[model samples]
Target: MACSLCIGTVLPILRRMRRLAVLLLLVLPHGASRGLEREAFEVYHQRRRAVSEAHPDGLILLLGYERQEAQAVRSPFRQENNFYYLTGWNEPGAALLLIPAQGDGSVYQELLFLPPDDPSHEKWHGPRAAPDDADIRSQTGFESVLPISKLATRLSRAAKKRSHVYTLFPHRAGEGKQPEPDRREKLQTHAGELPIADIRAQLEAMRAVKSEGEIRLIRKAVDASIAAHIEAWQEIEAGLYEYQILGPMLAAMINGGCLRPAYAPIIGSGPNSTALHYTAGRRRLEPGEVVVMDVGGEYAHYAADLTRTVPVDGVFTERQREIYDLVLYVQRKVIAAVKPGETLRGLTHKAKRYFDEAGRDAAGEAMGASFLHGVGHSVGLGVHDPIDFSQPLKAGMVITIEPGLYLPEEDLGVRIEDMVLVTENGAQLLSKGLPKEADEIEKLMRGR
Candidate 1:
């Protein structure tokens, strides 16, 4: 009678627990239930192998951002770019160590160090993967997963055997407050005499060339950004605040599944448009004024950069059309020149020459003088993704062709920007879906 009573009571409780588990699984995000949303394990695995091959005798160490405590006001956490590039692990307070193959027949090894699970922390922040979790290896693509407490010991051991420690060093002086400075200081104590090689250049080169998966993500970002721009065009008109136009664009980006803007969106109207990097969207647009809308969306950490200057009244005035046409002409000329073996500096020079020869500003000066910024920049993980400006363009590389003429005297600024992919033979415009022609833009705004 006692056994029967115990079994009867426990069966109902077990069924209840099972039902709760099922309900939670249905409610949680796919990435949360598994791990952070990321590419396949092999993509990261291949990248690690390539890095190991590059530095066969040295140890590569990458430190991720430390986890921040929950606060009333705190920015969302983003993983360190280089670390995320190598390992797809997005969780904070993780570290990656790559041990090169040894001559003594030891194989190349990669290890991921994760913070120990704190039940108290999880109570507030939700559950995080512990090193001992069953699926940690498959999730992180690192066969050897260990507690972060083991990081120093592992690095010390590896440093003693390795000839050099390869990691990102500060690129310049007075950058003491940057993320790299603190991480490098800590690495020095652990690395001791092992000469530290600045691996930043190599990583930048690797990141310049997008993998197939990265391009897909970038295309998604571009698509979302284009949709957002269209929304803005439909809603823009005279007497509306600059931010009022920005509202619809942001909504479109979010609805299209973008995580955030590539950078702060810039919506400058009238005189404000003449200021480069203008983000303040407070001005009330007036008739016959041009508003420069420089915006893009970031999807899955990849970024898209685009800019369009349109008339507030849905029609460009005579002077606006003239400057706009010159800017568009120069942009097309520069983009047409994009191909293998062409340097960004070269393309920039070409753009300036085109601007100078094509037209003059209201002040009778060369129009190129009005072009304040570089013609283009590498775009990927960063809106202005880092690359050696002198390096020649290669296939699979994505860059922007943006040419703008800012004439503060005329209170006019016109910029045409698009993302381009360097192809085997020529260039392919990734953001071609967005219309740049004045007629097309007017039609779009007029809903004709």
Candidate 2:
């Protein structure tokens, strides 16, 4: 009788232990919740470490915006670049708070504030992660996750001792809007005499240089862009409308996993070619005219920019070849001078000098007059990513080298652009596979 009683109790205990083990296995920590890999979250950790090191006594606050689904049609939500840089969290209306260590036996603290999931609303939309989710902390690598409603009260209590708080105030054009007004007021109300400092400068400086992972994402964007340009070369004909060619090219980019265009694809034929930034690709191509196609693709939030000009009928006329070759020559020279220790202004000066000495119009006006814009700009999360143009080029910096000449009188324009990566020794042409030479473009167009 004693043996049978002991067996019954032992069996129940063993079953409960098995259930607990399975539960623990189901909740193993994930690197990120979305499609992001572990490396991305590691990048976030590195950024947080850097911020904490710089501001040992302060707290960093960054607010994320919820998608305005009510105001517009539903679409995929994109997190602000700066916020995404620090945390791989992709949801909307979230807030992040970080407290740095002062080495007084204090520990660094990172917290994420999240909105609750409403089942009634989720029936119309979809369910979202809540503060109590174990993945919320695991995926974001945040120390703790709490309700967003607790932000003001919690921050106010922490800052009551006159602690410094750093945030991204004084928004720039491309930067997202500031934190919610009520929350901003509440933080200030509790801050008393403590002043809020802007951290934009520090963040921009950190983003200017490409890390290994960032370079990989950028290369994916550039490769997709190159494929799109090649498709455009194959499809351009003397009788097709500009949009007709653009349609297939864009399809190719999207099919290749680039869901967004870096910017509007600029397909300008004939007179439209003379108008920079002409995006209305409604013109029909005619034989003996040049078409300038400037388009790129964005992959994983990184961008690629490229421009190529070609003859509409697969052949360049004598005058067309003259202008094309001249522009190509100067473009190559500028690209060759893209090593470190060079500033954008210095490169622009060199381009101007080269154009002045090499070519002239009928009345002897300098070809440099037709050069309308700066030599190039940095490319990254934004097509025209923010940068200090006066700062010397650094290794891992990616930029575009484009030189052009537009002659409205003759109804002619020629531009050649390529993406380049500044390396330790010099530069590497990321878009080298695309044909830019007049002969090569013509040969490719002829299906040779």
Candidate 3:
């Protein structure tokens, strides 16, 4: 079907779906009755148990990284979603350890060493959630919470026994890069001086699998994200400035139920959309202009990442409709390819060919290179998470289906994203409340 016909037919149904979805969520039983503390502790225990069973004499380390000091818009020192999922602690300077059960009789093998609240620091930094006896017991399922200063001596002892040590240490981005320096050096020094077996692979292997608790938290994040996109769509205007829309878009996510933004919101209007990773949302939108807003929300600390491109005028021009439908086609097809035993790398390769057919390479570039980024990343505690590339897409894994076409010279970029959870049968769309069709978006904006 022609693009115009497709939009005319599909838009109304999508709008109705959005309305019904929103309604259902309002009446739905919110799973939030279970406090966050207990949920987080449960998730950590599941991961630790799996890892411990595999390597009984191992020491597992979970580290939370802080934002670099110099950057103005640094992400707050959020723990690695994986670390937070397992530790149930959110603080700038914190660490968690899972010492093995030990000869089947170690009384306090599961230990959490956190920064206890100091009165003076609490006064300056606001009240920190001090780990209470109940918190230490219920939240982590750990035996005790000690001052972080004890880690050194504990590690020294673990090392003397030549125990296995697995750490979720940092890694560099792009190709052929090594792990971050501070961590790389720390791991190297510990293994060399401590006589411990480097079992980082063991932790990596365990993290690849998702627990039922992780899946639940991820679903909540997706639920919050649906409202965020709609809020951005509804508040946007033909004559509004870019950042203005950006603010309300995020506010909607928080109001809808997200605790933190999954990642920096991408709010680009008009020609600014041509730039990938456009951070400065400063354009003044006018009629006939397109706004490419890619934003997400984190709920229970799990991430829901999504992207949607729409016309600010609430109606797509012929060219806009054509491009939008093409992008959607590529996105849907690639998502359909997601199933058990599919390699993400291979999935991207397959999606690229469709992207090319969708006119993404109107100018012609390397095959699978037109879109120029990974098909999508796993979305969980972090916006972009690690997946088990070595294994298949297990039933519990959640991922994003985002495919886009960027033409800097043409002043166009369109990406449609949705969060999906891998299921035994196929994939489940978690961000089901969000509308996608142009006509649907227009009708909803008109309050129809």
Candidate 4:
């Protein structure tokens, strides 16, 4: 009788426990529970290995962005570019540690530190992956995963043996509030004497050259941006407000599977075109004026940048065609010169020379004077991916060739931009799908 009563009581308790477990699983963030989207595991693994090999004498530490309370209502969260480049982890409050092989024959080590899941916060913001998750290591492609709370302990322990710690140091003036600074503070607190070296330069060099996988993602971004431009051509008309054109382009990008634009879509019409970074889309496009639509899309963290200048009406005026042709000529000339061993600064100088020799604008000033900004910039995770301007171009480097002449006096601005992939022999036009020729753009706008 006593054994039967004990069994009956334990049965109800076990059932209640099972019910609670099921409820907890259901409330866990979907992305955390099932693993968020990421590239192939090997891709990140190789990247981490490269960084480790670069700094074998020190410990490499990288911290991701912290969770923002306002982001829930204000904007979506984006992982830090460098951290994302190495680990491909999109979650906030994550850090990566890589230990190089010691001369004593100790093997290299890699660890991913993740924040513990907050069930209460998850109720409001959705499920988040915790370090304790059964599949956390597999999900993150890390051999070892630990709670973020243990980061200080690990750093302290590693610092005892290492002479230096390699991490991103803030070089920009206004970057004090970023993750790098926070990580630096932690290092100071935990490992007082260990020197902290900047790992940004190495990362920048690595990022300047596009890997095959990165190129593929960039191609996707370019294709989506091209499609967006095509949608704009179909929808744009003289009577429409500038903002109206932005909607269709953005819609097309989203439809093409892009998360967002690489940058703010610059929908500059008429005089607004003279402003290089103009984004005000409130103006009504006029029949005789030209509009410069500088837009691109971001896909899977990669970015594409493209610019097209077209007449608000179906055809460009005589003056418009003259300036447009000149810009196109310069852009093509620069792009043709894109090959290994050619430097970006050298290319810009070449483009400027073309603009100067092309002719004078309506104001009698040299056309080159109106060509503001560099001919192009590297494009990758960031639209203007960081690179040394003087560094020689290499195969697999993706850059933009944008040549423009903005004349505020004539309310005329022409910028012809295209994404180019540096090839083993020459250059490949990634934005070839989008028509940039004045005649071709006119035909598309005319619904031909």
Q: Please give the TM-score that candidate 1 achieves against the real structure.
A: 0.88
Candidates' C-alpha lDDT: 0.83, 0.77, 0.67, 0.82
Model 4 accuracy (lDDT, Cα): 0.82
Give the alpha carbon lDDT tens digit for every residue of 1-448 in model 4. Answer: 9999989767754654554445344434431222223578898888889999988778988888776621424556678788999999887888898988888878888989998989898997789888889988777888799999998888777765787788887646431123234467765665568888889999989899988888988988898789888877776666678887887676667666576777878999999998898887899888899889999988888898999998888799998999999999999899999999999899999998999998886678888999888898899988988877799999999999999998888898899899999999999999999998888998898992
**Candidate 3 lDDT tens digits, 1-448:** 6999989856754664565456445433442332132365556666667766676666766555443421214444455555565666666656676666666456436667766778997786676544554565654466667677777777666654545577754543743222342464665554455433444465545555567767776776777677767777776666567876765555556555665577778888878876667878777888887898888877666677888898887788887788788778878888788887886777777778886554435556642454767677676655666565445677777887887777666687777888888878778888777888777877887762
Lowest lDDT 10-mer window, candidate 1?
A: 173-182
lDDT per residue as tens, model 1, 400-428: 99999998888899888899999998799
Decide which is better by TM-score, 3 or 4.
4
Question: Which residue runs of candidate 2 sit more than 4 Å off their true CA positions?
Answer: 1-39, 69-75, 170-193
Residue 416: error of model 4 in Å?
0.9
Q: In lDDT terms, how accurate is model 3?
A: 0.67
RMSD of each: 12.6, 16.2, 8.0, 14.5
Which parts of model 3 have CA positions greater than 4 angstroms off?
1-40, 63-77, 102-108, 129-135, 175-192, 196-200, 358-370, 388-391
lDDT of 2: 0.77
Candidate 1 to native Cα RMSD, angstroms: 12.6
Model 2: per-residue lDDT, tens digit, 1-448? 9999988757754654454344334323421121232246768888978986888777788876566621224445666667777777767878888877665666777888988877996896688888987687675677688999888776776664436888765445542123322245544654556787777789878887888887887887788778778877877777678887676566556544565677778999999999888888888889889999999987776788999999998999999999999999999999999999898778888888889989688768998999887788888766787687798999999988998999999889888888899999988998898889888998998992
lDDT of 4 at 406: 87
Better of 1 and 2 by lDDT: 1
Of the candidates numbered 2 and 4, which has the greater TM-score value?
A: 4
Clashing pairs in 1: none
List TM-score per model, in order.
0.88, 0.84, 0.80, 0.88
